[model samples]
Target chain A: MTYTGHLQLEASERYGKSVLSDAYYNGVFKISRPTYTDENLPLVQLIHVGGGYVDGDTYLTEIHVKNMAKLAVTTQASTKVYKTPHKQVMQRALYKLEANTELHMKQDPLIAYKDARFTQETEVHMDQSASFFFTDSVTPGWSKEGTLFPFTCITSKLKVYQNGRLVIFDHLRLKPDEDLMQLLQLEGNTHVGSLFFIHSEVTVEWIQKLRDYLASFCDDQYGVSLLQIPGVCLRILAKRTSLIEKIFAAVEEFIHSTIYNRSAISWRK
Target chain B: MAMTNALFPILQLSDSQFPSGAFSHSFGLETYISNGTINSSASFRKVLEIFLANQFVYTDGLACRLAYEGLEIGNLEQLWQLDQSLYALGMARETREGNRRIGDRFVKIVSTLYPNQVFDQYNMELKNKNVFGHSALVFAIVSKHLGIERETAISSYGFATASSLVQNAVRGVPLGQTEGQKILVDIQPLLTDIVNRIMLLDETEFGIGAPGLEIAQMQHEAIDVRLFMS
Candidate 1:
């Protein structure tokens, strides 16, 4: 069966507290109640009610935040692209943030099973005052045929913009059935992770600390750089999925503690 | 005669003394030198070969090809998009800035030498901050203006990049002048292969996946003392 999902979130400041003024979702997508951390940031989890995607599944997510709203969005669990012998699975996401607003999207890595074809595209539109934090990851899933990286293909494109001017564009395409290591330089690694934090508030001190932190504990191939615009972007390739997750979590915690002066809440599944 | 005529312009643009400001930038090779990852001429040659095969062609070469197509069609929007893509793909701040500076200067020179409406439009967009001027894109525009063949244009840019990297290595690595020349000679076949292969690549094949090289560049930013810009 084909599935198409839509989500729209409009957040605004009211009574000295930022709240979700409008939330909408259709089809197979659902969201939980907002949880606040010490920083008073509202956090929500996007749940795929259908559990996983099959052949020919299409999902779309649209998010927006107005002035003074601080929000974090994450997935309930990893997105699973099951074996598809016929058609491909596609997902599209769009985010818009206005002045004095911030949105952090911590997406769980996509797990592609054998014969699966998954495609994803995400675009961020932001005002100069708005900051965006986003993460995207992909890992090979278990295959019944006992082959590593058995998935047919996975393609993902991410773009960032400030006031309609594109700041960054990244595209990743992996065809495991082919010689993936030689072409894209996966280097015999199975997991790929990327983090992007775009904000005018990113300072030199922050960059230094972040650089030091990444250098301190990395054992796999990883890169952390200040984007041409404001903010930082980190890209990692690892052999294990858990390692990527730990690295991202550590970086997020460091950012929260240093910038927000608050401890990041340790969320439980 | 036609081939030799095309060769002259290619040689002029790709010359090491072209004042493109590329010599001041190591394109991430400085970090490798400082970290001892590329100490010897042999290691340097290996890294350059891998860089050309894995990263440079996919990113810069593809951008140049796309830019040529955009100019050929006279599509300002396409040119703008190509510039944006190339700029954004460069996550390192110095790398992106270097590209912007070199590209802008290249266009300025081309405009003065041979004024054209497309170059003017690109300049206007750059002035308006609508697009980040990338070196590869500007080179494509200049090549088109000079009537350079598409294959020759792309190959010349590749040769220039490889040459600049070698020049930087000679200074940064403190390699002997003869050693640097030998390294360049060693990579000629690889450069030819890469140039040929890059021409066959589709737009989607352009990507970023060389973490070791990228990480070296990222770490270059935080190093207390640095010789090259990136």
Candidate 2:
């Protein structure tokens, strides 16, 4: 439709439980009913009805978690970016979490097909006490000519601010037209992924333990870094997207079992 | 006369022996060294080339470009925003703090040594805790105040950065000084080319960092008994 898509979700705490207070979607965005899991954490899934992200298409998503509320959002499947000849497909996600709130976004891999151009910017603003977790992955989509790196461009930028101070900013600009591998120093690897977990309790000891734990499952291609603001980011470059996903799964498990003293609910394919 | 006026200060600031405290940080190289990812001079050079093209051109190089532009427009707010953005883009905690430390020291020493208004104003912000200082931004301001050309300032900064890292690699990788000098000499052409590209780069092209290098820098923090501060 050469138009912009929109989605807004609001969640709050009531009676010691989190609830989806308000929701809105238009232009090919659909949300499944909120499902509450252990600890009153509501899981919401976003469905893209537009088939695939087309050229010149833009999507805007705004999510708010009110005081002490908890929310988790996921995608049903991988987001496919089709050819964007005329212009690049753009997506902007804005998230706000009030004091002591928690928000998690587990996005599926972005598969960019041949000649595809995609740019996504995600910004999160949270209180000092709030907790946020985010996951993103990128994979080269189908190529008729059987090329390895077919996507024209894939750019993902994320900025997280706590209490109105910029803390974490990560920008990944991948262009197959350029020397993509050498440009990013990926060491001949293709798939790329990142997980950012921001919480006050994230300490050096905890991150080191997580790093040591992941060292068995993950190859030397992956790295875990602590943000100065009490958070950790794990980034990996791999030839297979599955490896990245597996590492992230391990990280989630570690975080839940060690820090939260709970089991992470399995995310089935 | 003007060229010499600018050149001497640029050289003084760019010298590794200067009191900028940049030598204390490796940013991410130490992690790779510990992991044996950068054991040889060739491996170090490959990583360095990638870093120069992929990360430094956008982050530090762009900061200098933007800082110079901000100075031209006489906008202190622009410089402030640049400093904040540079600080924010550093995902590694140790690397981020290390940059802040070097930049803080550079500004403090230069402002006191040169006695310029813009430098003092910028230093005041840092002293007053208004903004986290970044070396690239400070380098640009110091260069501008010293009447150094923008391209020269950027090239000098790039050269200085490469040489300092080369020194670190030589020490950490246990390579000889000859190898360090060779690596430094080899990157001069790259320094020229990167400076040119950064000059024409738009602000939108700024803050680009590779996941691999960033991870290395991040992991450097956890290495027990690390050699570098970053």
Candidate 3:
């Protein structure tokens, strides 16, 4: 069966923040505070809900960050794409960050089981003075001793506009069966994540700070470099899925406290 | 009879000694070497092979053919479209900049020596707008101006670039001279097949995927210090 889910967040002066549901079976996922947060700060909460299957072909997830509001969105558990006897599963995420707002978006690794076929497309747009930090980690699913996922292709495009001018445009497409792990490819990396942080007013000093913070979580081989433009991009490759996820979480919290001025989110036990 | 002599211009245009600043740029090889991903001569050969088969085939090879045909028909719009497509396909800033630099150098040299109106016009357009003048486009313009056959010019240029890369690998990877020559000899047959494949390409089949190369190129941008401009 096909599944489709959409979640929209709108800020209300009276309600603090409201999660609006358009369709799909919704579930709330909790994110715990990182061990590093200061004792005085409150832990943030993330509400995750997914609607049931529609036709098994297409699924949609929409996240909206309202003006001047901050939100941290993450998955409660690693999402598994089961092998279908017949067709592939397709999903898309549309994230909108309004002016003066921030979204610390991260997700658990996606494991594609053997014979499973999946495609994901993500589009993000951030307004002027807005900040966005997002990470997507993916891993090959469990298969028989030698077999792996039949095919997995994920394409993502992130566009940042400030005052109607295009500031940053990032597009990525990944296909695992094409031998992405080959030396000339990802250099035999099984787990990889692309972390991007964009803010027009970000200074060189700030970039260095971010780089140092990212460097502190040293488990895998990762590289952090400043874009000639205003943002910073980090690409990390690791063997263990859990280590990568932890590093991602730490980076997310660092960005939240320093850039967004938001409290850390406490993960659900 | 005419075809045999026609091949000379193709060879000359694609020659590594053409002085279009091709040797100065290792095309991210310097970065890879510094990072230790490419330590030996053998590893360099592997990297170049993957680069040629995966990236140059789809990108520069296809661009060369399209630009050659575009110039032959005097289709500026088609050429512009091809240029835009190349820009979009290039994900790394340094790689994109390297292409423009090489293209500009080619146009500057050719405009003074060859003095072709088409070359001058294209160069002017490139300067006025931020149009990316990639090496493939410039090679096409010069090859066509020199009255060379399209397939031969494209293939020869592609092969020459691959050879230069191998030579750079020899130096950077510290490979023996004989080993470098061996690598070149090994790649000749592959170049022939690539040329044939490039010839059969259609515009609709443009922009084939090569993500690893894109990532490597992107990674090159963040590399702290590098010998090659790219």
TM-score, prediction 3: 0.74
- lDDT at residue A235 of model 2 (Cα atoms): 87
- DockQ scores of the candidates: 0.47, 0.67, 0.24
Residues A161-224 of candidate 3 have per-residue lDDT tens digits of 4444444444544566667777656666667676777776565577567656766656455555
Q: How would you class the docking of model 2?
A: medium
Candidate 2: which stretches are off by over 4 Å?
A: A1-3, A266-269, B1-4
How high is the DockQ of candidate 1?
Answer: 0.47
Between prediction 1 and prediction 2, the one with superior TM-score is 2
Cα-based RMSD of candidate 2: 2.1
- The per-model lDDT (C-alpha) reads 0.80, 0.85, 0.64
* Clash pairs (backbone) in predicted model 2: none
For every candidate, what is the interface RMSD in angstroms? 3.0, 1.9, 4.1
Tens-digit per-residue lDDT, A46-102, candidate 1: 988898999988888888888888788889999999987888998889898999898
Residue A195, candidate 1: Cα error in Å is 1.3
Chain B TM-scores per candidate, in order, are: 0.92, 0.96, 0.87
Model 2's DockQ? 0.67
- Greater lDDT among 1 and 2 belongs to 2
Cα error, residue A65 of model 3, in Å, equals: 5.5
Model 2, residue A260: distance off in Å is 2.3
